[model samples]
Target: MHFSRVPVRTLDTDEKSVAQFGTEKMLESAVLLADSDLDAVVTLSEEITKATGLPCSTSTLAQVEVLKKYGVKRLSLTGPYVDGPMRGLVAFYQGLGYEVLKTSQMNERNNVVFGNTPLVRIKELIREADHPDAECIVVACTNWPAALVVQEMEAELGKPIYDSVCVTLWKALGMVGVGIPLFGWGGLLQDDPILKKMEDVLEILLTCCAASRTTLRLDFLQKNCHVDTVCAEACAAGIAQLKQILVQNDLANTDIPPPKALMDVYAVRAQMLAPLVRGDEIYGWISVHQVGKTRVWTEDEIGELREAVERVNGILRTAGWI
Candidate 1:
């Protein structure tokens, strides 16, 4: 909850001097942090760790961890950074094998100017950097107050947004094993634990049903119905066909005739889908698939799937995600 500022004379300073300044500041703060008896220390910049050889969590590391957790390989980046730092950020992600679909920067080198940038302008920059193929958008610069706009932008864009300040706190909390359910900042802070529990439920359902695959599709924060978690093998084509059938059947729980193309292309023989409904609204559905050969769904299997749906709905309700 406490912050210590390390004043950099200029962001455009030579790299060596900047690194030296970071190292000195980290060394000075390490003593204070250790004396304060904090559970963990989170640095806003990765340079502190690189310069001081400290074992603290950092924003850069947290952002990468979150991207990996979300299975994001392609991203669009926006920040209040000049060309040099912007290119370096792009290269850093590229070195990690992530595809940088687009990048936008404010070209501002002054730290104060970066902090004083308007929130509306930051949102505009993020939107400009976004691409249809990009899995997520990254808002860099811990000083820019990007955290305040992450939730609003994610809802507007229908994709996750990772901001530096939020991710740094996320990493720090996780390191200390604090399971605080957070909301409103971004999906990383809000939905990570919920998603983890949903995935666990899918694994249990997969084992209990003795099926080839089990998937949990939910209408997440943006009300977009997508596969949120899967257990065992997943067939994209099979899931797509199942979705079509569900739409055609009016979201009812039924064993519809499998389309010939589905069988021919993906070898999906049978599927049992139960809609996750709480009263009038149909949030999404849980599906169990039988591949390679046709098998009639037993009453017990259908019953198990229905129970799983109820469990998922309970989770969604408990997390206030419904």
Candidate 2:
């Protein structure tokens, strides 16, 4: 039922609300840090930016130095570093005047590598995402098989870990935002800038609603007739359902023309009622009007359209958007 990186432990016992200590828990445990580690971290600032080909207004050098000076060398690297700038990072580190080491991909928990790096099955979340922005990028798990390969993993990934342990540490340290330094392991000590950016993109894509949802005035639905109050309310509800579908797909801010719009059809005067079913559960809908320009759309066609809109509507309801 949870969506974020914070782990969910479903309780069978009688527990009131759960306390989320994902990051804070990690930070409470003491770890040592240093100022020179920042030097080692900065050596690759340019290298990482070059490898990523993304502009970095923030200084990763200063961030790395902070982690190096204050990071705990606890045996919590998370899983082995996989699915990153694997080869390029090795070269980048060598150029940074640092020793780059690597380790075999292991599965202390024996996780099957389904699809390389970010594994995906056929018709998987990553695949059906269809849009690149829709894919969930999980960079780490508390039980990652590579927890033992901290130094080697960082050198290999060329990015902050952002794994389960990493986020936990970041979350914990964020509670006290003093300019403290981590020596070597842990993460960026605060927010992983790259991860934060990825999260921002994901949030926009997952939560956006279509800007093109033109609410139909029951009265002016076609050319100049407005629907009565009761019918108008129902239509508004159905249109809200339509909006949910567009938002889930990140297809918000739609700019399609009237002829090519999601809900741009006109309404006139022709009527009938039909059965509407959600699984065995059924509701009812009667035709309100017809388009004067186009031929009257049949009951079957309208029924199908209603079903599509309702499917998304159900999701909106589940998401608590009644």
- Judging by TM-score against the true structure, name the best candidate: 1
* lDDT string, candidate 2, 168-279, tens digits: 4443344334333332343343233322332232233222321112221112122222232111112212222111111111112224222223224432222222333445
Per-model TM-score on C-alpha atoms: 0.60, 0.20
RMSD of 2: 21.7
lDDT of 1 by residue, 1-322 (tens): 5566666544653685367456567767755665565666777345545544445777888999999988999999999887777888899999999999999888887877888889999999999999999999998888898898887787578788899998888888787876554655766775555666876777777777777677766655353334442311232222332221231121123346655665676566667777777668766777777666566666676777777777777877897876
The global Cα lDDT (0 to 1) of model 2 is 0.30
Look at candidate 1 and give me any clashing residue pairs.
none
TM-score of candidate 2 relative to the true fold: 0.20
Whole-model lDDT values for every prediction: 0.71, 0.30
